[model samples]
Target: MSETPTHTRVREQMNLSNAVYEAIDTPTASGEHAHKVILRDCLGTLAVALENSYKFGCASDATHSRMLGHFAQNGLTTNNITYAPYPEYRAYARNIRRTKPKLYSAPDAALAEVFAAYGDIARATWDTQGNPEPDSRHAVHVTALAAPYALREYPDLDASLVSSYSLVHDILEWHAGDTPTLNLSTQGHVEKETKEAEALELFCTTFSPEYPKLVTLVTDYEELVNDEAKYVKTFDKLDPGFTHFGNKGKAIKELGIDSPETFWREHHNTYVRMSRYALDFPRILEDRDTRAQMIEELAWPSAQ
Candidate 1:
């Protein structure tokens, strides 16, 4: 295994990160789709290493991230520069096999190892697309890291126009999710749902803009289900305070809509609305089962 100097390795990674940022984030970023895929892995490796270096205060430590904002505050300091890269990349690539089920070719693995070798990568918490978090600057970091990787593809900076324009699109989605709700009224509820729907659109559109037409079907289905949500009615009603514990059941005798069958019978119209959206987005119908499960959760008298 070859060992690159820690400083040289970091410089290389930083340069690659910058290239990747320009490739994926820049306005009118020019690149074939396949090029962006490899670039994402490049950014992921550097970002993971930087995050991990900050986490453990050294390249050799096997520790989870305790984000002290080391990169954010001091940037990459000298003490964090001792990276044993090729072997480090080997470890990261080998480890990927355990979690990533996709079959990787020998060349792909070699490419991943080389791509990952420029930094001291740390373990990353895998997250689902349903709830992307760290509501902070993750997207910025990812985009920033993408720049140097772009340079290999489009070397002439004077000739190529790369834009982090998607960063704005991503940030907009984050803003939408971060948009606060005043209350759980229909207005506030729709606003929140609409924002979530838009966020999904922005995220999915990174692959295809046509994605939204189908994705919206899921969003609209959710909105329709939310409309039938019992908690909506529960919010407006006055809480039956039991100042006197002597009377337990006497405080509230709200009509019970406990069973799924009962709920289906009572809210048949609402289910119809849900079905309509489901039928429209058949591609995602399997993903919308949360409503039936939620119905049971919201069946409590207090919830209703």
Candidate 2:
């Protein structure tokens, strides 16, 4: 018997994820070159996984098959190409079925705008330092992709609102791009902030009347106002941290970060900055502790 389309899609999605999962373990020579190769491979794997998961969730069987075929053909060619679902697939999937309507409303114009704005915005991480074309997923999509898993720890929070917050938390960054400003001077920070603020104002004015809650969620996320928004913010930090950890901190180690304290304090400062929020929500705190211990163990495995 032939496999059903749903089964085919599930298998393909797992294949995409497992390809990266296995690639991560392949040994390589140690050096800057090796780190660059590892970073590139990891980012590529993440991009494939994120895109595959999204297409599997939304695309019609025919559309997905076409996409899969295109990707497979490209894999056979020497011409450099990145696999991506067509825009028509996304627009057509506007009416697709959703398990959580609140978190994912069908035929939502505001949500459509959010998705379009973030479609190609590559996130800036330590791993993507000098690459002209980093295969990184956008923060907007990251939030939506991570919502189901992240919300499991915070059962008390409103999943809908928190998921909504995750969807739009980085909506303001739509126009400005995800430029890492860690070493930027005060004036530079002010300029970037101003640009982002203008972008937010424009977004809110365009969609606020129709999507007041979404706009409010974006505002709350920027201000760290409420528990739901704060949770999304924390998850934002953890999402990338998890990516780094999955890649075995190659990016961090390449940046000369050798200790857990430095990793927590410098690169992924999610826990350091949001520890206060964890105090108010012990589940968040517990999750932090668990992850922190994992990082510590990863850093000093001999001690374990």
Candidate 3:
């Protein structure tokens, strides 16, 4: 196994807080604040690592570009120095998998060992996509720790992209299952239904005075979906909040008018509004006076 890198050690320290785990489990108005703190700490460490790498000139720009290309190919990001087309990178990755099967094969190795290797690759890939100059030692250590599970589950998949996607999904999943009003009538489905109901309720109540505007936003989103317009391009550029609130608005429209409520109840958890609000709420709360005013505003019933 590759020696764990020092930066990876630092990252582990950054992410090792029990408070983060506890905060994730507990839902409160302050949950967003907790998440931001964690994200800021993690990203800050990464930034430091990148700066160190730059100072040392250990890794070349070409290497960084290649790593970024790998990320972009995997639907991770498109902001790399190369800015290589995603499809091209995807094709290259596919070709490499097909042509160099030995690079991924683990003949005669224990399943655990193979899995560990895969997890390491996934972690490296995640860091590469997230930042070109991730703390080298830290990234290596993280990848080493994470590789085994990823390899065990998806021997053929790109472990890094899969890991990245999983991280994003897990963050989004936390907002589910809190409110009983949103819980689906159906049994055995994911608990996202409950979360969706809560979000819809929040949007309706919080923006009640703006119902006409909400309806219009929903209508536009539905139209864009039906017409198969680009997902990010379908909404008004003036207010991204409307676009976010309209997450899955296209899917909801397909259910037909008679079943709007039923459709919303069923798929509310799948919408992006809650996730966006959760992420953005921290920034909104950063201003001490503004946060105080918001607390006051939110304390009152929606009718007010």
State candidate 2's TM-score.
0.51
Colliding pairs, model 2: none
Misplaced by over 4 Å in model 2 are 1-114, 126-152, 181-192, 209-213, 253-261, 267-272, 275-278, 292-304
Model 3, which residues run further than 4 Å from truth? 1-147, 173-191, 194-304
Q: What is candidate 1's lDDT per residue for 47-107, written digit by digit as tens? A: 2442332321221111111111222122331123221222333243233333321212222
**Count of clashes, each model:** 26, 0, 15
lDDT of 1: 0.29
All-Cα superposition RMSD per candidate:
21.5, 12.7, 23.0
**Better structure of 1 and 3 per TM-score:** 1
Give the CA lDDT, 0 to 100, for residue 109 in model 3: 29
Top TM-score hit: 2
Question: Per-residue lDDT tens digits of candidate 3, residues 216-237?
Answer: 2333332333221111121111
Q: Can you give the TM-score per candidate against the true fold?
A: 0.21, 0.51, 0.20
Error of 2 at 57 (Å): 20
lDDT of each: 0.29, 0.44, 0.27
Cα displacement (Å) at residue 152, model 2: 4.5
Poorest 10 consecutive residues of model 1 by lDDT? Answer: 235-244
Winner by lDDT between candidate 2 and candidate 1: 2
